[model samples]
Target: MKILIKMKSSLKDIVELIIQEFKTIASSYSILLVLIGGIFIYGLLYNYMYQPNVIRNAPVVVVDKSNSKLSREYTRLIDAAPQVEVYGTAVDFIAAKELMKENKVAGIIYIPKDFDTRVNRGEESIFITYAVTQAFLYYSSIQEASAGAMLELDDRYRPNMVVFLPAKDVLQIAAATPISVSGTPLYNYTEGYGTYLIPAVIMIIIFQTLMMVISMISGKERESGSIRHFAEQGTTLKRVSRIIISKTFVYCILYSIFGLFLAGLIPIIFQLPNIGNSYEIIMLFIPYLLATCFFGLAGSVFFTDSEAPILMIAFFSVGLVFLSGISYPLELMPWYWQATHFIIPAAPGTLAFVKVNSMGASMADIQTEYITLWIQCAVYFILACLAYQYNIKKAIK
Candidate 1:
């Protein structure tokens, strides 16, 4: 009879906590912003910005001082490349620089008068390329297009000279002169920035938005002296677990709907490849959401004001994106940052989602991240309990 009564009391406490959480959410415009605006509204806007996905036909001016057939051929090939367009020919370097200064062109390609002579002499022909500093994509397009055109020209023209060499040495000469390369891009075939960036950014939004909302609520509780009222509920671990579980349940349900939009609907709407099985994506999210919520709750113990967490956590947004190791190579990161990656839920979560969604990875492939998120879930759950226990003690005093 006594054990049953305790179970009943816990159930009643959980229901009351859920009800209070809903009431708090309903009353606060900021919380509404975190739940709705952060997900649906901002989500669409971000997708729209990355709609182009790939950069193409970035303009450049070519300075062809070579005036030889080779330079002209190089120019023709460069103009034909998908990444860049040769907007205009420049009479001199001065003219090319002017165009770049005016922003009329993203880059300048200069083929010196001696370029053909150097190539025919079996010497490396140096072509000067100047790209504007404004956008790295503009520079990338110019460099890629120029380099590709040069390689194609070298392969086609150099082979004719190899015909004159001894038959046995001919193979060696042709192979040695122009090294042939065949590129096979994996995962992102189109090399679209949208494919690479959007997946990771969406996950960060899920994390940061949840943290801010939870932290803001904690800050409000601290300010309102409600931390003291938590003491009245009792200091038992059972009571703390009830409060934590109920709060986590509310956010999980709300975010699950948001996660579906982020993982399922938004991808379809934006035409991001939804290669992963639906069940797998949903399963990955369970630990991710739980970890994020508990981590937020644990970290919120430091907030003394409602606005402090918004200011503090919001600053970490860009850092968190970098930490995802999408834009930057994870292997290149310092040891400490790499160690920190395992501690944070989103680092592995973002990479795992991308592998599954974009790379068509199996459950076994993402097992490392799957396990890491659960580890985080366990660690943060304990931390949140400890934080709440501390709050309860503070309240009693």
Candidate 2:
């Protein structure tokens, strides 16, 4: 009977704290800014910037030292490729290099003076191509254009001299090439960077915004000595549990709306891949939001001032994006980094969200990530309680 009464009292305290927390959040303009502007407004802007995800017709300068029909043909074919354009012709290698240095071109195709002579003499010839490595996309476009032109030339020059052989042997020889290969970019059919990147980035934004806002609120409470007010109301566990529950409730409710906007509405607006089942996407967020809430609460212990979390955590956005394994393969990462893959909610959350939303994966396909998020929820919830308990004691002193 006494335990039941205590439970009821705790529930009542938590309810009261939830209302108080909402009022506090509404009053603070910064928290509202993060919850609204950072999550939705910034999300829209980032998606817009990446809307035309694939770069096409990147400019390149051609150095035609050969000045022969064969060299001119190769240049024309390269220019015809969708990925690159022959923006200008350079008289010398030095002029081509200057064009690249001046940002006039992303790549250079140099055909040596001996190119035609070597081809005419039935000797193997090499075409030297240089692409700016500053951006991988630039390099990729240049390589694709160069390879396409070379392949076309090879098909044209391939001798049809199989007449001496028997009919079957002739056919086999005619059909044979030095090598054959095909590449398919699955899931991301359009091969658009926005399609590949925006979904993962949206989840990371949710995680970052929640942490920054919650940590800032915690810092304000600590700095203003309001933590002691909660401590005075009950035992340490009661105070900590109530605080965690209250804060978590507010953020979870608020961020669920943001999450829906990010994972659902924005994708529709931008025509990004939104193939995931709506219910499955909603189910995925249950653990994701909880884990983020608890992690933010536990980490808020380090914030002495509201500005501290902003300054310290803001720079970690790029690191979080990399850690999510969107930019790199998880298999190639070291053991410690792989461990971090499970530890950080964003890593697993981003991967799972992409699988379901972009790749049309079912709940079973994301079982590992779903379970990992639940584990994070449990672990971080305990840590949050402990951190808040310690904060309460510190405030009392």
Candidate 3:
């Protein structure tokens, strides 16, 4: 009977602690802004900015020194490509450079005077392309358009030797290339930048915002001396464990709603990729959220004031993006950098979510990331409890 009464008291205390944490978050304007603005406003703003997705008709200035029918036809073909448009012709390389310097074009294409001479002689021909170093999109668009035009030109000039071959052998010879190539893109059919990047960004935003909010709340507790009061409440191992649980519960519930908006509605609204199984996404998210929350709680020990979390965490936003292996492949990263993937919940979470959501991967495909998150959850939860116990002990001193 006495043990039952003790269990009831402990349960009541946990509920009260959870309510108190929620109230603290509600009353703080900074916490509310970071929680609300970072998730909704940032999500909408990023999607809107990248809505155009694909780069098209990037302008290029052509220097056609050959001034022949074939060279003019090549220029026309390049302009017709969807990736780039010829702004105009330049008489020489020097003239094209001036236009590029003026920012009149994204790139310059230089066709040598021998361009038509080489093609007529049935020899290989090459053209030089120059693009601004400021943005890679300009270079990519120019290269794709130029290469496509060159292929068409090559087909037009190549001899039709199949005509001399016997009828049966002609078909075989025509079909017989050393290798066949297909340029079709899988997963990202349109091959847009937004399609490739935004889904990963959504997961990253969830992790970053959750970290900031938890750290800010922890910082506020320390700054306002509220933690000292809480520390005076017996500071038992059991009580410290309950405090950690209460805090994690509040964050997990709030972020679940935020996660639904980010992972569900945002993709539908922006028309980004959303092919993952909803059941699988939820399964992945459960461990991700738990790991991130505890990761934040463990790191919160270092935050000296409410403002400190923002200062420290805001700098890591870009780092997190790169570390997530969205912009680059994880396998190619340096050994030391690759090791970080194991330490940061966002790294594995982003990769796993991208696979499931963007690539339509199954749960089995993400077993490594899924298991890593659970391991992090276990490890960080222990660290958070120990951190709070230390804080309470320090307060007693």
Whole-model lDDT per candidate = 0.85, 0.86, 0.88
**Clashes per candidate (backbone, < 3 Å):** 0, 0, 0
Q: lDDT: which is higher, 2 or 3? A: 3
Pairs that clash in candidate 1 = none
Q: What's the CA RMSD for each of the models?
A: 5.5, 6.2, 6.5
- Model 2, TM vs. native: 0.77
Evaluated against the true structure, the overall lDDT of model 2 is: 0.86
Candidates 1 and 2 compared by lDDT, better number: 2
Tens digits of per-residue lDDT, candidate 2, 214-294, equal 888999999998777886686567578788988899999998888888888999998999999999999999999999999
Candidate 3, residue 182: Cα displacement in angstroms equals 2.9
- Quote the RMSD, in angstroms, for model 1: 5.5
How well is each residue in 220-245 modelled by candidate 1, as lDDT tens digits?
A: 88888877777786877777877889
| Residue 30 miss distance in model 2 (angstroms) | 2.4
The runs of at least 3 residues in candidate 1 whose Cα sits more than 4 Å from the true structure, single-residue gaps closed, are 58-77, 86-177, 325-334
Residue 334's lDDT within candidate 2 is: 90
- Assess every candidate by TM-score: 0.76, 0.77, 0.76
lDDT of 3 by residue, 1-397 (tens): 9999999988998899999999999998998999889999999988887765776988899999899999999999999999998999998888889999999898999999899887766567989899986554667778889999999887776554345457998677668886777796788889887898889899889998999999888887777777877775688878888999999999999999999999999999989999999999999999999999899888867876888678777778778878888878889999988999889999999999999999999999999999999999999999998887787676557
